[model samples]
Target: MTVHGADAVDAAQSAGRTQLVVGRSDIVTPLARERARDTGIEIVVGAAAPAPRPASGPATGPVSTRTDPTPSTGPAGRLTSLRAFMPGEGPPPPPLFPPSPALYRRGAPLPAHVRIDTRAVGGPGSTPTSGRVRRVTVVGAGNVGMIAAMRLAESAAIDEVVLVDIAGQRAAGIALDLSHSAPILGFSTRIRGVRTLAEAGPSDYVVITAGKARTPGMTRSDLVGVNAGIVGSLVSDAVAVSPDAVFVIVTNPVDEMTEHAWRTSGLPTDRVIGMAGVLDSSRFEALAAQVAGVHPRELTALALGSHGDEMVIPLSQATVAGRSVADRLGSGTVDALVDRARNSGAEVVGLLESGSAFFAPGLSAARMVLAMVNQTGELLTATVSARGQYGIDGGYVGLPVRLDRSGLAEIVEVDLTAAELDDLQTAARHIGDRVGALDGAGAR
Candidate 1:
């Protein structure tokens, strides 16, 4: 079929054509251009008469928009590399996809003065579909990724949850395994696993878990150099396809890696958050709940600063049943709990003798995913660029934030005690120093 309108474009793609000859009457629509890009089909428009179809396979050359007499007026479509002008269609395009500094350009930050409206934020625990979120993509179908993918599928908020990994067959297998559970779990959300990032398409929320895990006797910092490279490449590739997607980084050395992601993807800092504080806060809360003889759900806790051992767990602010933890538990007991929370990941790494913590991390990832997908105003902890917040500049740190569909809606700054404040300052220095180091190496 000669490609003309949207229907013909679909028909050509449906028949698996390598190239399409543009007739004098054929008009290319936006969807046709997109399909051409996705399938790498070269569109040849005739100069004077009807253009001829190419040989076989895929066509390789610049798509031309010369003095060809196709009858369109105005822009046939977006003036992009793969798209060309048609002679039909009138009036100019109304400035489509105005480039956001966060998207195309680098070194720009989200405006600091943009006020966050509380009521506009979505409810985290609210049942699904109050917004436009339809798909969630998890990069890296490893243990943390697969489990996180499963949790998103179970949420019933998204229509499709995609799992992408470099290990093609293994990721596909994990996706297949989770897909089978949908029937028993009573969820309509489809779970699919693929080998490449392009296959995931445009996702509302992208949870990046595609990096190395900490092994026994290895500090989260120890995996930084390797994982930074891994996270950088993954973010670059994933961002190419899902340009509007919000990123939730779950890779180790998360604080540094989060910064790495923001710079590499050149996305707005708020939309590229690291999943350190949520998992760390959950651990702290779970331990506090156990010690205080309360359910974890009953305890509300905040773990801020860095994501690792240096994280600031403000016990004075943490409460269970509306009662301060400090009032219930003595300083000695609370100190022990904080130590446990800081060492939680290391403990699991040692115990497993191979794999690190999966269940808790995956749950942490899912909780964060829910907050973003539902546009929940729920105050949660995430690692985002610290623009002088807690005296941290030009680096990413874990802190309390109100999440919404737009990602970090507002940075919730709870007053910290002198000691907690000091800890946060130190973490800022640590993260800043390492971020500077990464910059020197051109890691970002």
Candidate 2:
């Protein structure tokens, strides 16, 4: 059956039909596909209708410049042969089928359109954006960076994600692998790999996961010196190209590295951030969920302070189904969860023996980047400058903040017990000491 334009959709709607089936030869206009998606009308393409025989008469049209001596006998094949086909000469034909119906749920409403800021440059005579042209760059191409890049590309929020590494070919290989998966994963985000940060320039956000990962016996603190040098240089180079880009620091000793990045980039405190607390909070939520016998989504948890042994998980703010976790699982079990959350990274390192944790860390970093680019104003834990929040005067600390394209939009202050506040202050002081040592070593 031939499917016309949006009229077909209107006709189907009027008929109370939820789906339309068309033959392969039937033409479904672009407007029809869009209308189907908008109105929850499923379009399925079946077999092609057989081409009818031409009138039993000689052809009257002008003869082709070239003749095919061995044209096929089939009517459809003959018709195709008669046409003057040229490659790469015009717009491609639309797909016979639309995207999977799951994408356009039968009863679900379409996603709300995001408002794009027209003031942002889109070249000389560009129209307002459709919120699909943002770019992100993930430096390092290591486990963490690779996972982060994959997550970002899979998000499909940004138009492109450039993966950079010192080993250019390795990055390219990883990008190629991820790019190959895009068709299967159903994302249109472009992935590119490059040797230099220069090629990843003009990015909207830069995620720095380049650093010496901790081995089985090493603590995150042990990576400070080695990773500081790596992170500092990457931030400097990235800032030179992406001056307005938000820098996400995912290197080890994250709080200290975040401070070093902030100081090195000479960008505003809000622009440079660290991915630590979110991962830690996720760990805490997972453990709490196990104990509470509830899905992790049902539990709201927050882990603050530094991202190391000194990390503090405040029980006051953690709840299970709106009830305090402590009340649900007692203070004893909750304390045990807190301790485990603090040492979760080391536990993973010990378990892997050769590599540190990357899955959660990369996902956490990607989540922060998505929140920023989408301007979702999501409340998240990030390592940002401590401007006297929680009585911590300087240095970077993990705190709850709202994220946007410009990075940290607001530092959300939640009520904490006196003991929790003390622990947070202690963690802040530890981070400050580490950052000071980096300064002393001129690693900043």
Candidate 3:
């Protein structure tokens, strides 16, 4: 049989058979004809013409032949070979019958295109199919707390968020606002506000931002008696509602308040953590960006010890654009940058003259919430109870902790300078004093 396409012709030529039956309809050039002749083979045009009935004898000229050894017998086979036919052949073998409808119709009761409602399989109006429906509860409805509730409601991993506040109206208003934004945020989570802690029962996580804000000229230490009492009450209520929830303390004096929360909540040490160093380090990064004239993202740093001025920033480990801070701007400038970082919070407080920062602090709390909900085992420096991890005991301190689905997974002990260690101990002692003050108040 004659091959029409260039690939087919090459394939046939490669097979060493130089002769080929071609139709008059075929477009073979004189040069190809000459080449075929030079190869000792006949290029017989119209050879595909049906034989003249045999003329009652041995077929005249050369009987039609198929170049392929296995002649086609099926309809598809006939179409593949049909292009080799001479003109006046009947309609090119009826153009192989359209793919069998029976083949597509087999087995299934109905075609796949038929839309079948899956709700019937799982019962009608059941909660939309999703992974385990995780619930989060944010305690407090102040700025930081509301912002955290909004962020959690925007996350896809959490299915529900309960916002609890002592002031029922405030929590309800914030929750309503968050719920209204769900359509815009493209999240399907439900946001609820409640007055009592009972509404947040057995949540996957509990974020405590219920304490009072820092007034002007007040150190986080100054918030001890007031915020500690507030944190203690909130912790007690939260523990009764969600003993299993991972408690994240975001109150001022976080290191001290976290210790109070753990003691009052009676949760395991691993279940209670405080948000401090991450926010502190964020401030440091911002200040480093100001000095280095680069994006804040390019600055790498860590804050340890407490959440206040006593918090130790590891200057030796700090870097800008992968170069050490000292290398980028020398030691004197680096020291100034460190001081700026250490005082950034106070600077903001001074600017506001009334309120502390909420944006970065809220974002920091949200990051911790996401780490827990998504089960991302990220190492973050959070305030946690010190069981003698860094030679400090009976207090809370900020240290790198592995956060995962279960909350505080592990505390990572990093190498520190002698001065760094001593400063951390001093900060811990400061926090211990605050905790002791709260304890004394409780005695009264």
Candidate 4:
């Protein structure tokens, strides 16, 4: 049957047709090809229908290229061959089986009329990008990274989550293990693991958790120098494939490592962020709710500063079911809760006697990533560059921020008590000192 164009193809598709058969004379539009590619419909045009093989398989003979001369349809005669499959050297494969992008990408010359859509291809050209991240790449594949990948994969909005790490086998194994739960979880997000950042392909967002975990008796500050190096390498690798990717840094010292990613990638200042405030604030709210005898969701807590012991919790700002937590728990209990919030990471470290927290950190990292991908403009605490307000310049520190697809959409500075402001300043100074040292030592 004759078809006019994409509209006809759509009509046919709506009528439950699974394949499109066209002659060499037919004009198959690009939209038709694109729709076919997306809808998994086979296009069988130009090529003669294949002859059925015998029960025992068809008799074989030497194959040779030939042309059909019996009848002419289109201006150009259909090229035929003795073999069942069409020759690879002939005209484009009816848009049914287009040339493998791999051929053009591996230094292989592109065939005629087959220029790579740099926006559609992953490698060997401009980095692929679209409106927002259907794909989230998680760097590290450690406890936090792995957990974040799993959480992202569970999101219905995400199409893929690629986990890349230096530990290739481990990453692959974890990916495979998580894949088994796809049926159980009823999610369609594809999860994969790769050894190299390039193998993760291009992504709209890259969540980074690729750094050494803090040990017992250690502050998040202690990981600054070593994690800075790791973050620099990871950010550089990610930027190579995903220049526009919004970065979510979860490594400690998160403030400094986020600064490293921002500087190393040279992306827009708003595109790189550290994930401390969410985890820290979540910890605070949970502890506050626990003592106040309320649901954790009813309490809202904010932590300003670093992700470590020096962080500040404005108890005056905290609310439990719309009332001040200080009013509910009194000043003394609130002080202990604040201290616990500051030292929560170390507390987890001590309990495990090895690794630090992953559950809460992973939850926070995933939330930040989704906020960016979904462009929710949600408010959360994250480590961002210090500039514009408060006069703190040239370092990363925790602050309440409005997050969206662009990363740190807006920095929200809540009214801080005098003591809270001093705590934030002290944390900023420590981060500045460490980041400054990194710059001086050329570790950055």
- Evaluate all candidate structures by whole-model CA lDDT and list the values in order: 0.70, 0.72, 0.65, 0.68
lDDT, candidate 2, 1-444, per-residue tens? 343567887897677665555653454544455565555555555533332223642223322211132222111011111111122224323322222211111111111233323222122223223365478999989999999999888776778999999974989999999999877877778899999999876998999998889988898889999999888888989988999888999998898889999999999999999999889989998998998998775566678999988888877777675467889999999999989988999899899989989999999999888777655434578898878788887778999887766888877677788998999999988888888888998885
Q: Across residues 1-444, which tens digit of lDDT does each residue of candidate 3 receive? A: 122333334444566544455653343322233333233333444434333322343223332222122233221111123222222323334222111111111111112222222121111122222343478888888888888877777766677888888784888888998888877877777888888788666788889898778777888778877887788888887788777788899988788788888888878888999999888888887887887898775566778888877878876556665456789888898788778877777788889998888888887898787766554334467888777788977668888676666777667666666887788888888778777877877821
Q: Write the per-residue lDDT of candidate 4 for residues 247-302, one digit (tens) a residue.
A: 99898888778887888998988899989888888898888878888767556667
* Model 1, CA-based lDDT: 0.70
Give the per-residue Cα lDDT of candidate 4 at 18.
48
lDDT of 1 by residue, 249-312 (tens): 9998889989889999989998899898888888987898898997675466778888786888
Candidate 4 Cα errors over 4 Å, as ranges: 1-132
**Which candidate do you rate higher for lDDT, 2 or 4?**
2
Clashing pairs in 2: none
C-alpha lDDT of residue 106 in model 3? 15
All-Cα superposition RMSD per candidate: 19.8, 18.0, 23.7, 20.5
Off by over 4 Å in 3: 1-133
Query: Top lDDT: which candidate number?
Result: 2
TM-score of each: 0.71, 0.71, 0.68, 0.69
